[model samples]
Target: MMQHLIRFRVFLFAALMLVLTAPAAQSLAQIASPYDVRLAYVWQNTVTLADGDGVPLEQTGPSFAFGQGARLVWTADGSRLYIALDNGLYETGGQGGPAVQVPGIFGRTLTFTHDTGVLYYLETTAPQDEEPGIVSFPLREANTALMSGGTGKLAGYFGRFASGTTRANLTFAAALYARDGGLLGPGRPTLWPSYGSNLFGTCCFPDPGLGIFTLGTESYSVWDATFMPGAAATNTTQTYLAGPTTNGVIRIIDLITGGTRDYAIQIAGGLGTIERVAWSPDDTMLYFISRYNPTTPLMLNVETRFPVDTSSADVTLYRLNLVTSTIEQLAWRADVYGISSLAATNEYVFATVVDSNAALINAFNTQQVAASLPSSDALLAPYMPQTHLWRVAVDGSSVADVRDDVWGLAARPIR
Candidate 1:
């Protein structure tokens, strides 16, 4: 029952195909501030060189950007890239060249084994129905292997998080699995029935969600859950966040004993919606990004949060003390619209700031994003918005800009 309950929302393949079939949108222009900002991105269906800072490296990509939703995955040593696209898994030449395409195949969430160059993808196909399972192929292969079978639902790629919370379970390759469209195939093997040793990473970083269901026009939260990575004794204790529905409450859950504790967060500033959440490396504090109201005026001359996109000035980064259950504002910039995609390591809280006016950029580049996209799903914006990378310490000190002119950024997952 525990395994069944946990297998609710795993692959999310429909989300992938839906995005693949969606129409193209706009692109964000590279920031030209004389400052170098580089990021690996799929442009015109080719694997282009991505630098952490915004700078063009000696790399080539496809003649046309992928015309659908896809994921760009790098080899362990960053020598090559496997691009999952509408056609199939496309390979890239790190130094810039035409992308190699495998005809008649489509994959979602391309990921690499923690220490190996082996590439795996969430493959779903028709007729067989169950064929849309987890499949893997090396850079040299045109043929693929069905790593695991599925009940025609989308699943997760086999990999670990950058924080070192390893995912080593060959049986359950998905670090955390859940269902969205509906309850997926029950008989599909959730654990590695055959290839248990073929998995990689730190093992498994499993997560449990508070059971939520909708009835008629109303919504009900029967449970709450949240998990943190820590020592062995602390790792099994997953806390579930509960709700005021109006404000919000943190529900700490115990994975081993199925026990729980409730703590109401006295959110500073004003009540806001939580988009992302992470914990301090020490497991003492919880951090989140929210469109929280400001209790006081923002500091001047600092970077402005790009609120123009949303037309609301309510994005704030907050931290909560686990022992005291007290929440406080860690940082905010009224100048920028809002904080997005928050991730915290022991050393820094990484976040993306919507700091630029995407509308004022070149129309040609915007057309590239729009024309190249498969559709205008919420995953990809209509126009690429100008974004910058920022990080701060857990104590909210050493706040600094890592790169500017970056429209999107992702930390290499395998450490």
Candidate 2:
């Protein structure tokens, strides 16, 4: 009897130890995901953080009045959402968290460096007194509780700023600002395309670790050029990716090795004209939206489709395998007006698609006319293309509408 009782006591002790120590073991293991919000976007002048299903996890007010230029980004850990507005920059705590302005931030474009914990922004020819350049601030300063650390200037006289982990690294247009001081040397040549207007901020999409940036031609002539920052302006071995040329040619350029490959992607009925492109999180695939029309040139401006003329166009989403060179048509939105933007996470590729119909077109035209007037404060409503947020599985399995009347989209960066 005593032997059985002793065994029972030993078992009871072991059970109690597990119950007391299990929480610590779980805490030490890395969290698969720290937060619930997996995407961030702007709709109706509000910035929203959403989950995989497009459910609103947290949101900030109609703060972005002129949200056309506003940039929304989340911290690497997904703890905060930074909304870059024309007026200033602000941050939120992700669950309907009140926004607190990051003081002294006056910039147009903003990008966060995950590894460095730095928030870099483009200080345009703004406020007229301060010198225009690339300025940065530690993200801890943006925290509502600890808004202490001030700003610092990194580089001078740049048209754009972007953070990269691949060979291209940190690119400040016409400037070379390395993450570590002087790693790329001073006065390095830039890859800014001369063929098109300096729309580098919009027309270019950077691969996370691929050392490649996909480019598109927006209302401009398609041209070829070879250039990469931190290298000679032109390398003899370097080949350039032609702009969104005729016949849906997708160019993948290697910034690290100075090589280029062109893929002429096509759909069932005809050729595809690329508008916007996005890179998957793993950097193995690229998601792009193109207009498929065999007969007429349907490449209207991706933005500002004034005098809307997309009646005969069919906008489709396609996934191009970087490893296999295989093109897969994931989702098809036929008879649509246009797709303004494309973004991707590990699970889905989200697009902001505009609906095409005759009546909405007329109202859009009226808004365009009113927009021209300096005194007009008109809202783009009742005819705003019936815009909605859509997500298609990365594996080309399914597609669904996540939200309505949404414009800008971004996938939360996972650290």
Candidate 3:
């Protein structure tokens, strides 16, 4: 009886998504591209990058209240910047103008396929315990709604994926969808058939050319679904797992051939757990941070594979070789305070350091692969306070190449 009820609810959710999406899909065809980066952070605002100078080309904001998380992607041409905020989806011109908001969602988590501009996100209606599912918002419908605030619904039904249970399991599941859209259409959620444990920390590379790849607590998995612009669905699946129960092994999966790769870093001592994983824009390397010993009040540790360990007596930055899967110690500072956040691009790596009362942005050049740290004054600058977003040049030209009030910034070539 329980199983039957669950299936019934899943079917209902699927129906809702289909009804909402069909019209939007039919009305819209192609999306323009060459988009700048879209940023959403804790303060519930959005911003866009204008040029390569690392400045806020244009700014838009206070769009929604509960924007817990967001992912920004440009269309293939870079003309439109799409932002998926918690419960709300929006897009704006590359130069930053009034953002168009897409309605009809009640949850967080957003992702987009750059090729087709087929927007994909997760949607959940009331009943906190019920599993949330994947939904599609056609670019045409979304743009129309954004421009005119038309009566048309912004979301279309895609399908439902599985979610995690406890906080740990929840982390894995959240990680899976962190970057990549959550698993669409379902059998048991990924990582469920085996461990019966909830998958946490989900992230994906949802390119049609690559299919979809996800990372979970025990391992990383890939699906066979090809997310072509206007095609019918194909078989969805979890292809592989980076096994043998270990903690803090941040794995990056390739969506094209279902390849599973692991980065074996002792991220967080055996304490709290690794929380964030970010991929470099070029998609060759990954950067992750782990908060360790959270149970102990005095000794809280924040560890990063980017070659720094904030929890130790000395703060150090490390260089990681993606092709070789190696780590080399680069720089060390005795008076380092705490790492607030980390961001990287193909050209440079930016680390936000928070000390006594001042916060700073540290920049590193990826071109210089050797493990020698740049001078502190040369690589970092005092970040203006109350600003969550900062932009830096990928070419290592000047730290002030561009400046904007963004909650988050990605220093990479936007496609």
Candidate 4:
């Protein structure tokens, strides 16, 4: 039952890895961007590079067969991209280059540090009695693995911070760790699964000249706990970290001073829970996805408390202005599951929305047809929903379907 629940949550976020006919490739000149922005995404089981407009610039040869836990990350300079697939991990040069498989390395949940050029990830294969540990590999020197000393199901690197202040630690699960695997301090225990990890570094960082590294994790008490990295045990303190609670409110901790700021989400009737959040590059605005209300009675261990599960049609995307504390709807699509993936830039916000209506129909048909077969005849696989990747203008002026059947997406750092 535990395995099934874990797999089900993953299936809800990842769409099927289908082989679809690719549209004719277009020249890079077809897109518009000031920094010549590029995006790395998993499209129809293949690793593809696209321009800012979501037009395919190049389709790397390597593809993910299962597309489960498939993730993509770009180097700070946008010269190289690291891709994690079901079979193994692969790397590709910026454009028009064949993806070379990174031998002896296959894992899930990836995070990259710009300062050290090291990629930290959780090992997929751990001893049965032992928990999976976080591992790191220097990008400049590949195939060499170093023990990061801590065990976590998810790992994240907070690379963006104000000048004169730095985040030298990697957030693994609900704790902070130095690059060498030393335990810095502990965060909230509820920071697992999706919403917690999604908002790791979305907002809240040490102010310039604070000379401190900050970390935060979601909690059930309506407010998330913030921590200042310390030797051995973390010293608890409030700092910049913000997200929605189950109570239809979003709260943030000040980065410089220790205080809390609460912004109530304007909703009509039922409670609103913001699931995922992304901060614009300028730090002036925030983009988030929300659900109307979650009334499903799920088991404690299997359900995420922060953003309760709701119907696909009840989800809406919103943006908030930090200066005026105002909220506005950015986009919303009916008959689709909540936005599973989100990333932002100065010009546009990218989101992955799964077609829930189609997924439900597929699930029903598969279950009904398989009911007649013996349990040993075949394993029942969860049907995944169709996924669409959209690039919406930062100002809410326009939205475009950059690609269909995209499971995971990562926008290259343009700064």
Pairs that collide, model 2: none
lDDT of each: 0.37, 0.45, 0.32, 0.44
Q: lDDT value for candidate 3? A: 0.32
Indicate the worst ten consecutive residues by lDDT in candidate 4: 172-181
All candidates in order of TM-score, best leading: 4, 2, 3, 1
User: Residues 184-241, candidate 2, lDDT per residue (tens digit)?
Assistant: 1221112222222221222111211111122232122112332222211111112232
Tens-digit lDDT track of model 4 for 93-133: 76547788776454433445443244444342331111133
lDDT score, residue 136, model 2?
Answer: 19
The residue-by-residue lDDT of candidate 1 on 126-166, one tens digit each, is 21211233222211111233322222223333212122111
The candidate 3 region of ten consecutive residues with least summed lDDT is 1-10
How many clashes (backbone N, Cα, C below 3 Å) per candidate? 59, 0, 34, 2
| Stretches of candidate 1 exceeding 4 Å from the true structure | 1-247, 252-260, 293-310, 335-338, 356-384, 405-415
Measured against the true structure, the TM-scores of the candidates, in listed sequence, are: 0.42, 0.56, 0.45, 0.58
Q: How much is the lDDT of residue 146 in candidate 2?
A: 37
Query: Is 1 or 2 the stronger prediction by lDDT?
Result: 2
Winner by TM-score: 4
